[model samples]
Target chain A: MTRIACRQLAPRIGDLPFNRELSAAAIRDAAGADVIVLPELVTSGYMFASPAEAAAVAVRPDHPLFAEWAAAAGDAVVIGGFCERGDDGLLYNSAAVVDRGGVRAVYRKTHLWDAEKSVFTPGDRPPPVVRTSAGPIGVLICYDLEFPEMTRLLALGGAHLIAAPVNWPLVERPPGERPPETVIAMAAARVNRTFIACCDRAGTERGQEWTLGTAIISPDGQVLAEAGEGAQATADVDLLLARSKALNSRNDVLADRRPDLYSPLLHRRAPS
Target chain B: MTRIACRQLAPRIGDLPFNRELSAAAIRDAAGADVIVLPELVTSGYMFASPAEAAAVAVRPDHPLFAEWAAAAGDAVVIGGFCERGDDGLLYNSAAVVDRGGVRAVYRKTHLWDAEKSVFTPGDRPPPVVRTSAGPIGVLICYDLEFPEMTRLLALGGAHLIAAPVNWPLVERPPGERPPETVIAMAAARVNRTFIACCDRAGTERGQEWTLGTAIISPDGQVLAEAGEGAQATADVDLLLARSKALNSRNDVLADRRPDLYSPLLHRRAPS
Candidate 1:
């Protein structure tokens, strides 16, 4: 069994020094787990008013902040979101995969959420499935999880678990229902037959209340653990169960894909 | 507003005459609804013992059975599944869309489920988004809902509502959880910003129990209505809500798609 933990922490906007320590502490707190996840923009809180404000807290991949996470991670592989300052001088909403060896992979968020388009340049490349000590872990930022193609891509790339760093802004839902984003995640997990750990931020930031809907979902699309009036959601999961996409003797999820008929998805459709 | 009704009927296997009347009666019973959906293979039933057994009950698009449904349908558009005998002599698991105008479109199940592979030839063409009096309604059959690509394709094709005809076999699920198939449909509905009505068969056939998980979901991914201990799941939904893909002013679900990065979905990946 692989132990996965998600720390739902509140990051102070434009406060790098404070966030750096808070994230590192969260990682240390979850040190025993095989995989640890923190919410999106853990190093720099969301709701940026301008590009300059976002750039103020943006850090390069080589920044010492990752090394701090690596030091605290112990043997666990830590995945967390950050404000990224790329070599080309553009800011990106990105996530970094850090293990004991330091930064292993960095994935820029390709699908930016509302108002993010004004502050960050969308990543050109697809999300990465980084091979880790626990397993091959796929990385996706908040809005990316809403895209079924993104999850399907990662699953096809042989990812056993997908660690998503999301800062889900509060949305209205019917009473007794889970957050819409969580529902989307559950569907993605079941269809791909892959485990998913979504780490969502907590606390209200600039009047934008977070959903605080961190969840660790199993391959069967069950919520093994969830952050409910708590700071962490953790689960011990058999990551190897995701290695086989078969649901029964005759049906394998990945093998049953009809890719030849999916060409329409490659082109954008005109608005209805 | 569209009054969608899903009739969860029990079809007796290998008894086409009985099933034909049962489905026509179901359509007539749901005549007041704007859109009526029926279970997959409602005309032939599932769990065939052999290809010959399936072939015995297979039908073509021009079969008089659909005319019976159309005659009883009134103004409502009806979508239901059947065992299809193709003109080329191959058998297919397919769904037909009918209205007062007769058969509008036929979509073969592209993703065949477990045990279905043994008796039916897989559909080469993509599922159809048939333009109807109610709106453009997409059709999917059984396991086809498990494939995110199929739903995404129909949503892109300007479908306001997706009508799925499913014969969901009973599967183990964690207590207090909805069926996994329903979860997948909810996710597909939300991500695509489209409404979905899944009509699932009820009762056991050949000792194969059904999930009886028929559901009507809104664009927001909430369960508008579900078949609990009842024979039908009905919901009065604003289909126009799905026409505007916008969640907010800045986020349009369909516009946010990064189709350029979705090329990976067009090719099959080696099994993990």
Candidate 2:
């Protein structure tokens, strides 16, 4: 069985060593798995006290912890998020897909959320779907999943699965309701017809807790597997089923799109 | 007979008199109706050349079109989108629920799409359900429907029917597939367990042409009724049946939710 895992991580803000140790340990625990994903910016948590703090925690790819993770998870392909210094000397919210062969690929999020916009410039363009030992993998940080167009593009590029690393905040629209995380996971899964494995960080980051909805949403929009509330959880996924759904006809939101018209909308100036 | 007229209209963006006149004419064509609904942002076009151009068309309770539309519709209650100058002096993408007594309630969109952020701010808050001639009517703009919380709030607040006006862009993701608008509509209707009257503007606008697949989605996530391909459409709603469905305990997403966990997630901050 080609098993994929989405592991919920618990990281303290600004505690890079603790987060890195946790991630390395988790990768070790997920040994022999075909693939694994972790939450976005987990190396430095969701937010930093200032740019200096962020820069200090954001180590270079050559940093020892990353190499340790790659060596530890050498048996399985791993994808995780970290803060990287771009060539332009700016910081980027990047996802690094790796194997024992060093970094397999890197994807910088094209769409930046509110505070993110101030910290990082949007990426130049979306990365192409990369072939993996398990399947074709496409990686997006948080916020990118909400834009159907971005995911649709990845689907068109023949990605069998989409891996997202999110730090979903706690929300309560009703005294009780479906968390936005579940909805987004469900929507992404249904539209792309691909396995969506997202690692959501858990625990309270100074009273602002995350909904640790570590979930593996199926192509049919079912939560095939999910972890428990709070800190850590893991899910198992059958990679083949994800590809089958990607190739399926009826519900393929990407395959069904009339791109001729939308490509224009993708540009800054969409038609009225 | 409790007749409701759900017409798909393409009122000129920001042309108040033209929009009112177009609706009045439709109302005349379907006289003795209990309700009338127009397209999303019907008061203004989807893309505004500038914020001022968009705001130039907004209206409030004292606007002349409000009285004119209510009177012209005679006994029918009208729901449609218009620009409203909010308390903060900014404009909102608002929908006015008008009846003989005047404007019953107004709902601004909770979730603003890409370009909309440049012009309109998100509605101050989720609105309370308003009692309508047919039953309790809840109002939300287009993107708001995408956020499940918007619908859940109204459903929890006792809304049996939801009226949404939308300006959907035309796009071809697949060679021969239905537009995203159709799929989203069905998804919203099914998830909310309320009859969805979605009036969408068809045809090309300013620079972007749109796919005109307007329809009324049923509580079961099916397109109960659909319109033709262009700037006009309509569908009849059976309020009694929808109410009965909501009342029943079977097959409703609303009843199946695990509210305890969801409430915290709904109001949570966006993922970092």
Each model's TM-score?
A: 0.97, 0.55
Pick the TM-score winner. 1
Candidate 2: where are CA atoms >4 Å away?
A229-232, A244-252, A266-271, B1-272
Positional deviation of B136 in candidate 2, in angstroms? 22
For model 1, residues B1-272, the per-residue Cα lDDT tens digits are 78999999999999999999999998888868999999999999899999999999999999999999999999999999999999999999999999999999998888888788899999898888888999889998989889888888888889999999999889999787888898899999999999999999987889999888999999888899987533788899889988888878888888888887867544756434
Residue by residue across A1-272, what tens digits does model 1's lDDT show?
Answer: 99999999999999999999999999988867999999999999998988999999999999999999999999999999999999999999999999999999999999888899899999999898898999899999998999988999889989999999999998899887788899899999998999999999987789999898899998888899988543889899899999999988988888888777786554656444
Among these predicted structures, which one has the highest lDDT?
Answer: 1
Residues forming the 10-long window of minimal summed lDDT in candidate 2 chain A? A263-272
Q: How close is chain A of candidate 2 to the true chain A, as a TM-score?
A: 0.89
CAPRI band of model 1?
medium
Expressed as tens digits, the lDDT of each residue in B204-262 for candidate 2 is 67777656666666665556566764333445667655553331333234443333322
Cα error, residue B85 of model 2, in Å, equals 43
**Model 1 scores what on Cα lDDT?**
0.90
